[model samples]
Target: MSPASSHTHRPPALAGLELLASAVVLVDADGTISYANAAAENLLESSLKALSRQKLAAQFLNPEELDNICAQARLHKFSDLRQDLTLERAGRDPLHVHSIVSVLDEPAGHVLIELREHLQHIKLDREERILDQSQVNKELIRNLAHEIKNPLGGIRGAAQLLEMELPPLHLGQLREYTQVIIKEADRLQTLVDRLLAPHRRPHIVGDVNIHEVCERVRSLILAEFPAGLTILRDYDASIPEFRGDKEQLIQTVLNIAHNAAQALSARIEAGEAQLTFKTRVARQVTLAKVRYGLALDLHIIDNGPGISPQIRDRIFYPLVSGREGGSGLGLTLAQTFVQQHMGVIECESRPGYTDFRILLPLP
Candidate 1:
């Protein structure tokens, strides 16, 4: 038996296409899309059926250039010829990609277009840096919390002693200052405890239904903002339960949802606030430098004024908040909890939309 013949091969249509992390689309000889992989579906923000119904030119800014490249590949029967292209999808920002068009040697004249998003490289690098920074921030928070925690007790005790030492009638105005010190010390103590909570708490793992977590968060949000906020659930019932800390997941989702609700206070008062909890199954997602075959995609989408661009990049940083009264540890703790489960959390915000996407690996 020959060595090459001894090995087994899998078809691209069945396995190869789906396994790829990059967006891929198979176009027919007539320039109509025949197939789109999962990544392609995500990139275009559309489904396979929808993508297949349209021609390739519908997605490209320079359709003629894309057509010429594909035509040249077909004419010369060449493979591996790559070019930079911009894909313009309606209602979404244009995407820049390095496209590789390969002519398949088939009677159907199928051409495979592999799209490697330029932004993906930037995103991956940013995620790596974020992860690194998250670790640094965590260490810093622990140390700072400890340092502040020790002094907080002493400050509150000293204020309490001073209050007891003063006469109630004669020190009426003076007592108020001591009371303020005590109150502020207690508040700082609470903040320090919260900063240390994630690290101190043990992760208790069990089978977690992501929808359950979403429903719990939704219920909590609706209960708090019952009159004005509208919370919608767009869940995929097919996703199976994965091993995770249920309470932690609930808390993480609630923190993000609560923040969204707070950000939508204006819209809520105007009766225009909307929060959607969407759940889907993603394939071939890379999270925190590790790629997973399948992952749970949870999206917390809100229609509000959107997050300010100035602090958007640092939203996950400890003590960073866009809201005035925000503790800022909500998202930081959420990120930490999600990372403990080997997942990733990301945010994208603009004028009318803000999306927090959490990707958790499925076993």
Candidate 2:
């Protein structure tokens, strides 16, 4: 549907304080847009003149979610409400927006809704907490590894030594058991190293072409799985090189792409998998009260089964995985690396498509 002209609208001052502070819109229980604030107008890409009398549920929200919002508004005059929702503009990666519903009683049936982007705050807060916890987790792992590692080596060595003395048939069985112990010990040591790498390393910042990072990850993912999967590219060539650590940038994209690929496994097997790497330039975006004005947008999108609703909010938390039999640290680590680069990552998912969008400042 086409939007109306942007010229007609009420003054910004009358749009309520909540609208001033947040991206919000007013809609009747039938989902028609009665009013929209400046922020909401921008997000919806339609001015007030165009938005008035438009159905909110059919136009923007998924049917089920729209019904739920309407139910809440109909049920009470005032109620505390919170929901995780997504907004995809112009066929783009879905923007992960957290919504808070507050009702307004007036002649025109309306529901006062506010939306806050989750990427900024969570990226900053979660990263700080994870970094600290990683340090503590590292120390405990190092101390434990050292104590058990020495004995583990001796145990494996003794088993090997005894195996050489035994007959061939019995030797093979004992040798296999010893190998298990060696393998497990090696895995523990590897985990400890990962915990320490981010803390011990110095960030090497330089003029980094965001596209280069996407290309590199694209090549790596294709090399690993060259069949039954498609890697689509949608990039804004105008994006400038940003100051970032090359290695870290690569890791961040890799971590996110790897997770998407895992989630797309079934689709890949069916020859219907798709993974897109896209970049754009977002203007005048405010994050954490500071307006960077211009930000680089990178998106990792896929068509697969969506993330489970259960862990959606905590998806970025350490060791939280949407897929079964997954380590879950990929996104946690990706978030950490992006935070180090002073970037933000937002996510949205449904049954068929899932999007992870990363925003970084331009150099």
Candidate 3:
């Protein structure tokens, strides 16, 4: 080695930069966290002893992900940009962090890194708004439906009673009028029930296995439409049980799947209809003005005729449907239930395949 090169050291001005910096983690090649800037300790919610020398992967969202990062660091020494990373910080919400790793010029095995918060928080603000809109819609339907219930019941009863009293000639005519009122009332009742179901019930949060939820939805859909479609499971078993209302989750997932099934009817007959339920862990997800260190990532993918350009943008809006016979409330209800659990759902649809991503915060 050249004499001047071997003697090079961290410039005096740069020595104290890391010591007083605002980054979350600092580590060496053995994956030991040798130093954590004050901001890092605060973000992780622990002190030096609890964090020092611990394997960086131990506190990460997925340990294997850290391994991948380390591998990247080893391969590309001058590549200063670290891709966004999610971390499961103890006693704090999941953090969506963007990071950078660079080779340390002096300390041979040292890698200097810095991280910043990412895209999870802004999403929660949108969810809060959706919840408000759903509540208003539910109240309007329930109150209005009640008004129709009383008068319609009286009209049907009076018609039947009159038919019994009047001579046989006019009895049939009165019965027909009553039948009209009864049919109309029943239809109105069904409409009211659909509107009120989501808001009328209390959320039952518990330890729910996401895979079971997927399996149940799969069975129900296949039973209803078996031949033309394929339902595949791509699950990450390490995903832990999260606190969620099982029935609500079932309906939430079911509505999306049902829509995909309908869209794929033609593809199914052609032996190309495909639906996949994929699960993984998302770290540092921000939803509903909150962050979780770990979140459930569920993807519902389908191969179909794709949504029409006209109504595609409004699919989740109440009363918007591309189908002639559809109520258009399925996706709306799905969005409400997911928002109740502080989850965010987004959709991407094109000519052949559509993807719905559900990100639920891990408990």
Candidate 4:
């Protein structure tokens, strides 16, 4: 038979697999791959044409186990089977995935396989938890700020009144004590205002160029750290302008980058610090349980001592900080502003590497 005549055509029913986020593959009774979806192609790091040319069992390190599973499904022993397997790649790290095998009714010997990366599942779970926790943190902060604000004002007012009512003879000595009380109250009031700032400010909307925001932040950071740190830009110019608050977006990026720079102080002094601002367009992204066709994938990466494990999970919560003397409100406010634009921020950190990723929907 001619090469053209021997080429296998994919069944129309399999086209819908492309819409799914999970990787999917279809194999014949002989264990030959007949179809691979977009997600599958990406996971396998090969095109459908190439993947189809190879046996499905060859993709995994343990081929006999996969063949046996396919055989069981083909024999009608079980309608479905689930297992965790590791996929071997040519030049990349092995991918651990949870695979589900289902026997197709129409195709006598065909089996459908679905794959979900274990890390992706963990990431999705973490994102959901962060979203839920963020809501609770905001409520707690707002209520706590208001409660503290009322008592703070009263304390400051009473201190001032007592300072004024002090006798002229003892005023000099007594005034110092009242002044300390007044100053501490003022400081607490400032903290409360910052805590409530995100909730009080109106979101100003406009067409924002993410690169411009990055540039502004870059200039600011460089101005502060001139000698030791290196800030690299890896921006995709094809990203279109999106509707968002330019100032808020700037603040979001600034707060993240600034924290990274501060964390790099030790490395900065040694002249080996590095920070990277990366931007890309993410397709078929799901943020806060809502899927979007396109989204902004922004990363603020730094090489520094990683965030402490004790507070890593609570970094976005108000008053949580990894650094000594850190007010801990920077990341909290950053999360709040991003949420206002229907976006999400996620962090992954380990010794020598920390990545803060921000995902925002695009039009």
Candidate 2 error regions (>4 Å): 1-170, 288-290
lDDT (Cα, tens digit) per residue for candidate 3, span 137-244: 667766876787677678767756765787777877677776776677677667767777887899898899999999999999999988978999999899999888
Query: By TM-score, is 3 or 4 better?
Result: 4
User: Scored by CA lDDT, what does every candidate get?
Assistant: 0.87, 0.73, 0.75, 0.88
Residue lDDT tens for model 2, 1-363: 234432244546554642354667776667777677666665665657777856655544455785586677667845748878777676656677778887766634567777777775766676456556655654664576467656766766675676568777787677777677667767756665565566668989788998889999999999998998899999889898878898898999999898888888898999999999988776545543355757887888999888899998778765577777776667776776877776777887888888998878774
List, residue by residue over 146-229, the lDDT tens digit for candidate 4.
999998888999999999899999999999999999999988988999999888889899999999999999999999999999
Which wins on lDDT, candidate 1 or candidate 3?
1
Better of 2 and 4 by TM-score: 4
lDDT of 2 at 101: 82
lDDT at 162, model 3: 63
TM-score of each: 0.90, 0.62, 0.66, 0.79
lDDT of 3 at 33: 72
By TM-score: ranked, best first: 1, 4, 3, 2
Top TM-score: which candidate number? 1
- For each candidate in turn, give its C-alpha RMSD to the true structure in angstroms: 5.0, 8.2, 10.4, 4.8
Off by over 4 Å in 1: 1-14, 46-54, 77-80, 89-91, 168-171
List pairs with backbone clashes in candidate 4: none
In candidate 4, how many Å is residue 256 off? 1.2
- Worst lDDT run of 10 residues, candidate 3, spans 3-12
For the record, the alpha-carbon RMSD of candidate 4 to the native fold, in angstroms, is: 4.8
lDDT of 2 at 195: 50
